[model samples]
Target chain A: GAGVSQSPRYKVAKRGQDVALRCDPISGHVSLFWYQQALGQGPEFLTYFQNEAQLDKSGLPSDRFFAERPEGSVSTLKIQRTQQEDSAVYLCASSLTGGLGNTIYFGEGSWLTVV
Target chain B: AQSVTQLDSHVSVSEGTPVLLRCNYSSSYSPSLFWYVQHPNKGLQLLLKYTSAATLVKGINGFEAEFKKSETSFHLTKPSAHMSDAAEYFCVVSEDTGGFKTIFGAGTRLFVKA
Candidate 1:
């Protein structure tokens, strides 16, 4: 793909139903990131991966929110026991390097609606 | 902790008038700064970045920003506004925590009036 790709552009889940969001970063990009954007707000960092290593997950809201990049190219963000508050647009970005001054490209995002 | 504050939630300007979006940042280390624009129902696009090499950074669409370290500000400016320039803007600060971690401001919505 020319840029980062994400699956399920929109998702609607019943309260307490689990959902999984997928991200496919740009080819050979060493850094991948996940962010959550509430309506009328900027994207908030959720987690970061350096290749296959999950370097940071500090921004994940709760224990039910988990992310993994097993092969370093594709990543998944899984939410267990979904809540209404979890409704937001989930964005994925990729950078050539996870260092200072690197530019990151973002995907259109997966819009989640938890009822 | 590194954070950025966008001074205005919404800014309105005439199509031909100048544009100014104010931002202030707080960081414990030398930071990397950026501006990203989001069109309605579209993904974010990078406008510009400050990487310490220059105090004045020029971005696409004739937009630019000056990094004022003493003032803790990085304000985006354009000589004239265009109707198409209406969008949401975000001010971001990235600091190295093992690797670079980025924090984004709430966002400023720009409205260009005809």
Candidate 2:
């Protein structure tokens, strides 16, 4: 079965540019999450959505970071006016249920470089 | 707030030697603990999880972790190391504080020597 899918495994953008990263969660998954990981560090939470409703966006670093899951299955993280400090890997994860009883799976991640 | 701490930033072991990666968590509620492994160029894979059911949890690829509430630890261990086990390991924790939120610890990079 397909776990989770992310597009454009690598991306390089000029500073102040805008970029959008896409994620395709597994079929029937009710929960989706996004995280940012810098080199040599663990993943940091970005946002989460349960079905079409986004319940958490507190982890988003700044207003420049925006995410949307209009259809509930596919989600997008958009960054406006990117900065060099935003260089990191964006990871997408999903689970059958967001409860503590279910396990979450992750995608290969889209590595972004801001120059 | 919930958080996890991976004790070692890195650990090296020879092939066939015992492997251990330690993690400690802080949560206000009964926490769900998980261990995930990420190989180079690959996505994060679930190794095991403990959801307050059992103290000892076993995962894929011959990995296991013990959830000790007394010491607030969920340490992953393997009886023997394989060269292919070299990768980064992350200890994750989820807590339901009004809403469920998961947090990841600083990863532990395992170097398996042949």
Strongest candidate by TM-score? 1
Q: DockQ for candidate 2, please give it.
A: 0.81
TM-score of chain A of each: 0.98, 0.97
Candidate 2 versus truth, CA RMSD in Å, comes to 0.9
Runs in model 1 lying further than 4 Å from the true structure: none
The worst-scoring run of ten residues by lDDT in candidate 2 chain A lies at A97-106
lDDT per residue for candidate 2 within B8-98, as digits (tens), equals: 9999999999999999999889999999999998999999999888799888999999999999999999999999999999999998775
Candidate 1 chain B, poorest ten consecutive residues by summed lDDT: B93-102
Q: Which residue pairs in model 2 clash with each other?
A: none
- Model 1 interface DockQ: 0.79
Question: Per-prediction fnat values?
Answer: 0.69, 0.75
Best by lDDT: 1
Which candidate gets the maximum DockQ versus the true structure?
2
